[model samples]
Target: MRQTPDCVLDRPSVDDLDQFFSIVSDPRVWTHLPSGRLTDEEEAEAILVRLVFADRGLTAAQLGARLA
Candidate 1:
């Protein structure tokens, strides 16, 4: 994690579950997404585990390849 006078930047983890859920479940977030907002904390946790945390093992090159 990196912190500066402006803000702190860090990867999402179990520790961020609550905040993550709050953000993901907000209707404002759905405005730009074709997908629906997360329904609850449980759903958020599942998404984080399946999508976010699962990507942590990849290297930059692997991530780039996946993106490509």
Candidate 2:
């Protein structure tokens, strides 16, 4: 997690499944997404699982890493 005075930013994990589903399933969010919004909780969970595992090899700091 990264925190500044204004807010805290966290990486997506299984713990955020509900919030992730709520945002992605919203109609407004769907309109802007080419893949469209999530269809159901199960689908959201699957996606989140993939996301969580996909990030397992990286750290938050490395998200901004570059070659020197």
> Which prediction has the highest lDDT against the true structure?
2
What number of clashing residue pairs does each candidate have, in the order they appear?
0, 0
lDDT of 1 by residue, 1-68 (tens): 99999999887777788888888988898998837888878888867755563667765566557657
In terms of lDDT, model 2 sits at 0.77
Per-residue alpha-carbon lDDT of model 2 for 1-68, expressed as tens digits?
A: 99999999999888998899999888887776747887789999877876776577754455335212
Best by the TM-score measure: 2
TM-score versus the correct structure, for each prediction: 0.64, 0.71
lDDT of each: 0.76, 0.77
Roughly what TM-score does model 1 have, to 2 decimal places? 0.64
Clashes of 1: 0
Candidate 1 ranges with C-alpha deviation above 4 Å: 3-5, 58-68
